[model samples]
Target: MSPLALGALYGIVTIIVMCSGMPIAFALGVVATSFMYFFMPASSLDTITQNVYEEIASVTLLSIPLFILKGAAIGRSPAGRDLYSAIHAWLSKVPGGLGIANVFACALFAAMAGSSPATCSAIGSAGIPEMRRRGYSPGFAAGIIAAGGTLGILLPPSITMILYAVASEQSLGRLFLAGVGPGVLLVILFAGYAVYRARKEYRLAHEIYSQGGIKSAYLDDEHFTFAQKVEMLPRVLPFLILLIGVMIALYGGFATPSETAGLGALLAIVLIAVVYRMWRPRDLMPFLNSTIKESCMLLLIIGMSLLYSYVMSYLHISQSAAQWVVALHLSKWLLLAVILLMVIVLGFFLPPVSIILMTAPIILPPLREAGFDLIWFGVVMTVVMEMGLIHPPVGLNLFVIKNIAPDIPLSDVIKGTLPFLLLMFLAIILLCLFPGIVTGLPDLLMGAR
Candidate 1:
């Protein structure tokens, strides 16, 4: 059969397997390995195995599991709760104070967690109750949490960025650094919108206040001693240390992405055990179990993607697709706009990992040939993937927020996300127009590296 014919068959089978309710890992692996065994040399099986192993064994890929573990550990500890309390206390006086705090806190947590579901679950659990209690609409609460959760991908140390770096043979450190600027920009935009909405709707000022809980002096209660306020800062110090240490290491070139993740995971454990006093020796078993479970799933999906990529290569599918795209003669920016739109649409049905793994092989070379900056493209791709996380129907973040705020209807969750979604789009547009926003940090970091 012609290469085009083989590629077409592979695509059709892939969609069928995915739509059949089978796990993506099994579907991708089964289809790819079956095709390779039947259409190519039987010995190709060895090559596929080697390829999968190499892909999974990379130093950069190590960051994924570590980040996952960090997120898991923090979720199970008081550090997350404490952080939420502090943010809530400070922002509660605004119009949509609770919802606005949810956006900022989620963004901060996203920088550390590097996973959307985890960020949504952690911050939503705390923020949702507070927002509802403060008289904010439940739909608005869930929607903000869901929308903010997308920062897990946009922020540095993002597992999605690490995965893309591996898939595209780009630098993990560079990708991580590149994400920082765009991530901050998005957070500012989200916060600004929150402030504007709160002011217009509630007529509040943009005043900054010190962080405090219900027990603080700002309330009707008696003020605590200076010693007590000073003591609370120490309770929050672990998180500050984790953030500062990771960013400093990344900037100073002291560690690779995986190493930074390992450090993060280590800090998370220490925070739980030492700072939160929640991690007893007995908790280790469940911690390890959860880590293994999540790690296994990620590795399985990754293994499948590798095998699938091999099959696509054997069929010359990516080559043909790249040729066809180049043949279109569209300007690079226009083609990217089309690709971004498609990604947003596909995101409604597929997880970001599946989308990136399946499409990166087909789409990347054409993007490179079109003279697009790989680093900028990686950042843009992340933003697009994040959009999928907050979009309708299968938006995992939305569901997470809903679970946190059970009283909120699904339709309300969808409606609340619309404004945040527009902000996300604006962030993407800004990044596209000024590629430096994504590349500047990476360039500086690489020089240090």
Candidate 2:
């Protein structure tokens, strides 16, 4: 068979295997190994060993585990719960105040968690119950949590950004910096929509406190004395400190991305273990185990992506596909808009990891060859990928909220996410129009790097 034909066959088979319940990393390895054995220039066993190990040995990729650990540690902390409570206290008075708070809380959690499902599960467990108790419709609660959970990849320390950096061979640190603006904008859009809904339906003007007012309940109440507030401050202060500290270090070049992640993870563990005593040594075992499983899953996908790209490269398929894209001679903006639309559609079906691993290779090279900014494309793609988390049917976030909030119907979750999804689509367009919004941070940082 011609290399192009073989490459196309491999691509189709890989997707089929993944969709058919085969593991992605194993499927790619099997396909690549099979291809290597069957094609010309038959390789020795050592060649396979060397190639696989080399791909996995990249230093740039080391940041994935550190960042993943950092997110997991924080997600497992008492401080995380306190932070959620603090956020809820402030935003609970709106019509769907807890729902809106879920979005903002997800955004904040996204900064630390670095992955979507983790963001969904953590926030859903905490925020979904609050929304349920407050009389928010179940569907809306589930929909909001599902939709809000997607912020994980758009925010800093994102595993998607790390993977993008690996696939595109771009700077990890710059990509981290680049996601900040778009992530913040998404949170604002989500919060605004929630507030709008509350006003329209519930006539809720402000968040309500358990005891009618913040001062009476928080300040003079016997339930929470002055000393208790001081104690609460410790639980509260670590989250803020970690956020500011990580950003400053990244922005100032005080630490490389991996170094910063290592620092963040170490600090997080200390904050949980010793500082707050929320996590004992025994408690940490489960979190560590969770982190390892997640890391392995991500790394496996990445390794398989490397092998798949290698197969495509050897077959000259990536180049051929780019040639076909260039042959169309389409306008850049029009082409990008079409691609973004496709991503939104795909978001409804494919998980983010699968989408990023499968589509990025085909789309990214062509887009960059057409003179679009890779950094800007990264942010746009990440946003579109996030949109999938809330999309109906297979949306993982929806399931998370549903699991946490069984009383709310599935339809309400879908309805609640509709407005936010529209807002996300708008955000995609604005980022496209002003590529500066996405590119500026990365460019500034790249120069420094």
Candidate 3:
């Protein structure tokens, strides 16, 4: 059979198995193993064990567990609440300060946790009720954090970025740097919209108060003395320093990704212990359990994914697909739009990790041939993934916020998150118009891939 036919069959069979309610890991594993047994020689079959071992044994991959542990350590502790509280204290004077604080807290936590659901659940649990109490609309309250939760993948130490780095064989450090600019851009846009919406909401409340509404027109009138704000810092400052210091050390070439993740993870544990007083085994078990569970699942997927990719290589499917795409002679920009659209559609069904693992083998080689910078494309891909976490069918953040604010309808959660989703698209546009936004930090500090 032609390589194209083989590739099509592989995809068809895999999709059929997955559609039959088989787990994704099993589907990918079964398909790859079946192909190896049937299409490849018996000698090739013997290497499957070695390949799976070698795939998981990667040094670059060690950071996955460490990062997961660090995120879990903080996510399970009071660190997120502290972080949000301190930020809210500082920003209280601004319109939509509560919402904006949630965005910043999400961005910072995203840097620490590198997982979207964890970020959403941690911050949403604290921020939603607080916003609702302050008279912010339910949809607005839930939407902002749901949108902000996406930062977990766009910010540095993002597991998604790490996975892309491994799949595309790009630098993890460089991809981390690449995400910073776009991540900050999205934060700024989310905050800006929050302020605008807050002002409008305040105006509406004031008009209602003129007719003797139950409450005053003011939106909580929260205030904090500088000294009080400073007081809120002690519980929060160490983690801030840990975040900054980790980036500096990683980008400054002081450590590799694994070492940086290890140091950051250790500091995260210590800070949470000292700050949250979580030294007891009961306190510590939450982060540990989460770390082991998520880490093992990711490693399993990685091993299976590597095997899946190996099958493509063995069949020359990837090579043929790359050549066929190049032969299309399409504009690079158009090709990018098409690829991103495909990613967005996939997001409607599969989670980000699955989308990346399943498509990277096929999508990446073509992008490389089109003269696109794989690192820049990686950032773009992350932003697209962020969009996936907030929408329907598989929008994890939507459900997360809804769970936090059970009184709020899921439709309200979806409607509230829609604006931030658009802001994500705007961020993507900015990156496309000026690709430098994605590459500048990495190119400047890491000397460009």
The best candidate by TM-score is: 3
lDDT of each: 0.78, 0.74, 0.88
| Strongest candidate by lDDT | 3
lDDT of 3 at 288: 97
Shift in Å, residue 131, candidate 3: 0.5
The lowest-lDDT stretch of 10 consecutive residues in candidate 3 is: 214-223
TM-score of each: 0.91, 0.88, 0.96
Q: Rank the candidates by lDDT, best first.
A: 3, 1, 2
What TM-score does candidate 1 reach?
A: 0.91
lDDT of 3 at 315: 97
Q: Write the per-residue lDDT of candidate 2 for residues 1-449, one digit (tens) a residue.
A: 76557767877876677677767678777777777676636754347666666876977678889888888887766555676776666654444556576887788888877777777778788777766555555666666677778888878888788778877777777777788888878888877777766454343212343337332211221133455446556666777788889888977889888788899888888877766675666889877988899889878877776776776677677677667667788898877877777777777666666566666667787798778877778888888888788777787777776776776677787787887789988998788778778777777766733
lDDT of 1 at 187: 78
Off by over 4 Å in 3: 216-218
Residue-by-residue lDDT tens digits, candidate 1, 1-449: 87777888888888898889898899999899889888988888888778889778878777778888887887666666677766666655554555567788888888877778888888888877866665455666677788788999878778788788888888877888888898888878887776676554332211222333223212222234555545557766678789889988876888877787888889888877887676666775666677889889998898788778877877788788778878999898898988888788879888888778888877888888888888789899888888888887788888887777777888889888888889888988898888889888877757633
* Model 1 ranges with Cα > 4 A deviation: 46-48, 93-96, 200-231
| lDDT: worst 10-residue window of model 1 | 213-222
Better of 1 and 2 by TM-score: 1
